[model samples]
Target: MVSGQLFNHKLLDVVFENANYGTIIIDNNGKIQYISNKYCEFLEVDREDLIGGYIVDFIENTRLHLVVQTGKSEMGDLQFLRGSFVITNRIPIFDDKEIIGAIGTIIFRDLDDWKKMNSHIKDLLARNNLYTPEVDQANGARYSLHDLIGNSHEMNELKERVKRVAGGDISVLIRGESGTGKEIIAQSIHQLSTRSTKPFVSVNCGSIPEHLIESELFGYEEGAFTGAKKGGKVGKFRSADGGTIFLDEIGDMPLHMQVKLLRVLQEREYEPVGSLQPKKVNVRVIAATNRPLEKMIENREFREDLYYRINAIQLVSPPLRERTEDIPLLIQHFFEKAKARIGKRVNSIHNDVYELFKKYSWPGNIRELENVMDAGVHLSNEEFLDIDALPEYIKRDSENIRRDSEKIQKKTLKELVEETEKEEIERTLKNCKFDKNKAAEALGISNSTIYEKIKKYGITE
Candidate 1:
């Protein structure tokens, strides 16, 4: 029995000395019974000085003795020793179901080891902090109803509809030609909704690549694919939980993605790419598109089911030419806005400039009007915006209208009135780029009236 005990002690001593980790063993009285050579090297102490000494005397913030007293184990606890951090595990040594001592093992041999294991984690956390606020701001609504800036009857009715719809949780579809402030209307609705305080995540479905749209909307797991982030990313849907998601250009979303989007809209849950678990989210969806979804559905470019799902409420934004009466108000609003931005004060605009603007059809809507005002504010040296301040395209268009008016002046009084009406009708049609429906709307006349005039005057594009 003595020889057997001697062999066991030899085996333990050999194992402790050759072990790759730093370890120490202490008796129930908290006196160190054994210290590995690796442990002594970690502390920069000699084995002679540490052996038989109380562990607390040599180690700062030591907890191994507490483990012996409590008869418990602490796994993966961080400890600061000799100005460096080490991850350690402490366990009570058992002998016949009674605690006789305690053993502490250090997982990292040194500070460098701990840093190597944690550097990637630290980087990922830093990136998350850096991206969080940016994500919030990018996803947040930047406009309200007051930003719509129009006083036409169509504008008034659209505003009223938006106000009524803002109080509900129904999905909305905003349809208009490009640059007609479709996004502005969508944002206005979101800001007035109960979910206004939460994130307003915006995604341009057409802007993202087709292959990557799924992952961008429903994030991927780490290592799920090549070049994935170290930690999985939160997708737009998850980020917009309990808030609104403004899907700009939703019509441009690919066919496959449309099916997935339809499912999310119906089920209110989605599984991230490469993840089996589905995440539930409460998000209000507001979609905008310039494309005619009905036409797209007919052509099989868009899904009919998805269209019906998203179009629970529909809002149409009238084009700028259709709201010609609002041009002066819009110009003054844009002029003032531009004055503040450019640090120039233009108190007045030439009447001819306004006439020119009225004559030119704004195909780009309010966005184009703002750009023109911005250019005029910067180019005008005088306090009034003149013809010279206009863009070259507008200037040429204005000259053509002036020449047409001059030719009308040479006719007889009754002939002059009829020619003036013809000129005005033709000009309006030309400004609307020969879209009969839009031209009728712009002229505040019925489509049938415009069609009759086109037939009577024999107007041809």
Candidate 2:
């Protein structure tokens, strides 16, 4: 028995359908362009009679037109028909920035049968789910807030901030030092937003060459340039329509491209390199950078107007040092990931290794920490990540810090105070050319007291 019944028999023009599963395709106008012969057999209807009919007229409870209009997928939706629940998936077909049509598939004829999935079907679905060719092309969000791995105050605040701003389509500027996981924050925001199913196109503005960025972003026609592709291609902007585009290292974007980007943000439209007509897009812009945009603006290296436009809502990711409490959590997370990836039996991290990790200042932040874990896991000859497995810098820095800390701990409070005072007085005297009066004034002390301290500390300069 067919799930859809012909409601409109009037003829309309149509074209397109995929038949691997009981599939159907409809044009933007909801007119059925193609119906698989298998489905026609299932419906016991003549293919000629259904081809030009409106999908709603031919299919029971169809939402194909809804996807065509919204350009968003409706996957695994339950449709109760003929005393049983059926599962359906409707996906919009996009041509550049516009939705051309929608395709549908009858995933499950009945809900009960779907629950006890056959092994072959389950494997096929699993492989497709891993990365449907469409998904790879979509640049879907890979990480969500749940994968953000942190429990510190700073991390909690950052998570809350991301949650608050993710509901809107406004521009978001993520400011942080390099390797502070700015892109992770960007992905989390996209995944949490209304456009989660849509593409999450990430472009590292700094990585692309200066000469190619414009065409890389706005695209170009086939004959626009000597080295252009045969058919021409949609730019990242067009590919990101109805979704989010994460512009990483945004400060490195050239001034000319910034101008075009500013216009696109203002007008929500852009012209491809050789196209006469401009195409409109509905995309959320999430820009991130480690550079000081204000400084860049002051130096005239960045556009002030564009800065304000993208910085309407700003988020600053705290450096790893600022969230030290989360270091152990991140360590464990990376360690486990490395274990699985490397297929190693490294069972534990030594207490000394943890101490060194906690003591060292992570200049490269979380990225550096992850690298160290990977190296240690690979180098470990035993079941633990010990000092022998760590990089040389880790041990050297840890030892130096330990020695300095021991020396400081051995000093009495009064001796430490005097040592600090002596260093300050000597530096001041040298800067003042050894003039007692000048040194005293600079040190905020009386001349006589300065002289006494200098003498007491045995300063002879």
TM-scores for the candidates: 0.61, 0.66
lDDT of 1 at 47: 82
lDDT (CA) per prediction:
0.81, 0.80
Evaluated against the true structure, the overall lDDT of model 1 is: 0.81
Q: What 10-residue stretch in candidate 2 is worst by lDDT?
A: 7-16
What is the lDDT for 374 in model 2? 94
- Give the alpha carbon lDDT tens digit for every residue of 300-349 in model 1: 99999999999999999999889899999998899889999999978799
Q: Global CA lDDT of candidate 2, please?
A: 0.80
Which window of 10 residues has the lowest lDDT sum in candidate 1? 117-126
